[model samples]
Target: MVELLTARGCDVIATVGDGDGLLAAVATHAPDVAVVDIRMPPTHTDEGIRAAIQLRAAHPGVGVLVFSQHAEPAWAARLLAGEASGIGYLLKERVSATADFIEALHRVAAGGVALDPEIVSRMFNTGSRPLDRLTERERVVLDLMAQGHSNRSIAELLVISERAVEKHAASIFTKFDLPPTAADNRRVKAVVAYLQESKP
Candidate 1:
């Protein structure tokens, strides 16, 4: 990864073994962008992304390009919990395409988005948007969800059982691929996805 990036004129900063070290290096050196992996030392679950979120808050000027083994909607949504500017998420496999990777890096550094092809396709593909996966009833529940309705509220609004609304919301979340995680706000992310797909 270092060789691929350096060959394209990206200055190689310190590479650390843990997320804390990565955050510290960025704070110390303050590079234009930081390439972070999703998993790191210890848990290897979401250390890198958690660090990236911290970096986003601590240093808004520094862009974050998260590289992960898979293009997961859950992680992608978590990374994009707030602003989308200066954020990029790409599958590790996409790095094999030198030009694409470099372009994504540059775009993120310049406060633009550069999502992986598969993610982008899943997001914006005509007739195949992620929203399409939801059933009609689930779509209604999601619309209520986007409007800040709780499961009980949604149930009341729709004249259904709260348990039914919960089931529908859970189905909505699953279909949207926004998995539950303690580190990330799955509800807010779900609304973001809902609103994004709602955009014309």
Candidate 2:
């Protein structure tokens, strides 16, 4: 998998065996993204998921892509807490297609978030809080922002001005208690906060 990713133009920064190694690699290399298995050495009981969460908390700039044999909704909820950008949780079975996997990597590397459809369906079915406070337009903006879209790109997609996009972003930051700053920094903080609040 690492070779494939490298062959497809991705820079393979480092590879680790266990969750601790994964976290260390993330801290040391500080790569743009991380791909972690759901199970890692030393208990192999959701260690990767835990490490992924810790990585997000410690290094918000690094995107995380978690692969698991099972659709662990609890793990998904944990990862989804605080922030959504630069984060992904996927089933190992879905990675068979090279193109799809590569696309997912690109999406995450670019600061776009992705979640397995199965996981989304499960999360919705498990009875979560209703996202009714946000308007339709706000939701659209949030999704694009989570996908790492710039104000210009968002404005273009929404047929609005960059200033309008900025206003919407400001509203989101206020609502989420995220500091309004440079886009990248704000995104990381917002995502971390979003994930933190996702828990019951």
lDDT of 1 by residue, 1-200 (tens): 88888899889988888888988999899999999999999899999999999999899889999999875656777777676567888889988889878988987898766666566444443454667887878767765554345678889989999999988878877877988876545555665674354344
What does candidate 2's lDDT look like per residue over 1-200, in tens digits? 88788788999989899888988888889898899998888888888888999999999888899999886666776887756678887889878878878888888877777666565445334433332445667657866765456789999999999999888877767766666555556754544454444455
lDDT of each prediction vs. the true structure? 0.76, 0.74
Off by over 4 Å in 1: 124-200
Cα RMSD to the true fold for all candidates:
12.4, 4.6
Task: Give the TM-scores of the predictions, in the order they appear.
Answer: 0.64, 0.66
- Highest TM-score, which number? 2
Error of 2 at 34 (Å): 0.5
Error of 1 at 22 (Å): 1.0
Pairs that collide, model 1: none
